[model samples]
Target chain A: QKEVEQDPGPLSVPEGAIVSLNCTYSNSAFQYFMWYRQYSRKGPELLMYTYSSGNKEDGRFTAQVDKSSKYISLFIRDSQPSDSATYLCATGSNAGNNRKLIWGLGTSLAVNP
Target chain B: GAGVSQSPRYKVAKRGQDVALRCDPISGHVSLFWYQQALGQGPEFLTYFQNEAQLDKSGLPSDRFFAERPEGSVSTLKIQRTQQEDSAVYLCASSFRRGAPYNEQFFGPGTRLTVL
Candidate 1:
């Protein structure tokens, strides 16, 4: 099984719709969960970050992590066309003395007007 | 102010060629990272550099892959004798972390490499 699994979505939604993107991981060693948004041909940008199991909210975006189920989510409230991008979920663990990052295949999202 | 800048935003090379991708990180960032993003997939970790030293490179795929951040400000990832499988977008990121405050990596506009 992949260390991190996210649906390869080409999810289409109307503007102002609430968007929920999720990911599941098999590695319990994973501690930090993060969400990144990538526009076409651009590199992934940091969107939300959370540690362990809890929820963190920033403006219109909310990130949730469930360590017990090894699940993580990024919720976009009142989404916009600008939110039409790939949403990638990634994790990191301190294996040795530094960081070991693991990533999932991103979910491609398109919010139309 | 520049966020992060990568040189030669697009590169095309024949198989067995060598290519160098460059990254100029944000000033004063302590940690740098390299990742490979194949089509339709998220970025995969390639290596990490902290200051002038490369602390962990276990994620690097093979001997053909190498990265260096000699001055601790700019980093370059070099791929030697590249194969067709090496065609992917290479991304660079830098962060400020002492022992791990927050791994909120700031990424550059990647260098897309295509090998034919």
Candidate 2:
């Protein structure tokens, strides 16, 4: 099984809708979870970052992690057309010197007007 | 301040050809990383460099893939005898510090390599 799994969604939603993107991992050693947004033909930019479990909120976006279940989520409030992009989830462990992240296939999102 | 920048924004190579992709990281960043992203997929780790030292390269798919950061600044990823499956976007990222929890990597626009 892949260490991290995310639905590669072409999820379409209207403007102002609340959007929830999620990912699940099989590795319990993962300690850091991150969410990134990528536009077409562009590299991904970090959107939210969280360590361990619990929740971190940044303006209209909130990131939540459940270490027990190995689940992570990013929620966007009042989504806009500009928010249309691919959302990728990544997990990292503190083990050893290899800090390489395990990433999931991104979910493509389109927020229409 | 400029973010990470990668040269040869786009490249096309025939199968079995070699290609070099360059990354100019943000000045003063201590850590550098290389990732490969295939179509409709998330970026996969290729290698990591702390300054001029290569710390991890387990992600390199084969011996044909190589990366180096000399002088602790600019880095290059060279693919020798590329295959059609090698077509992907190569991304570079840099962070101000070493390791996670303290380092937040800023990514470059990436180089799109098309192997035909």
Clashes of each: 0, 0
lDDT of 1 by residue, A1-113 (tens): 88999999889999999999999999888879999999999988989998868999999999999999999999999999999999999998766666756899999999999
Best by TM-score: 2
lDDT per residue as tens, model 1, B1-116: 88989999999999999999999999999999999999999898889988999998988999999999999999999999999999999999998875883588999999999999
TM-score of 2: 0.98
Candidate 1 clashes between residue pairs 3 or more apart in a chain or in different chains: none
Where does the lowest 10-residue lDDT sum fall in candidate 1 chain B?
Answer: B95-104
- What TM-score do all the candidates reach, one by one? 0.97, 0.98
RMSD of candidate 2 to the truth, in angstroms, is 0.9
lDDT of 1: 0.92
Cα lDDT for residue B115, model 2? 95
Tens digit of per-residue lDDT, candidate 2, span A1-113: 78999999899999999999999999887878999999998878998899868999999999999998889999999999999999999988768786777899999999999
How well does candidate 2 reproduce the true complex, by DockQ?
0.73
Give me the runs in candidate 1 sitting further than 4 Å from their true place: none
TM-score on 0 to 1 scale for chain A of candidate 1: 0.97
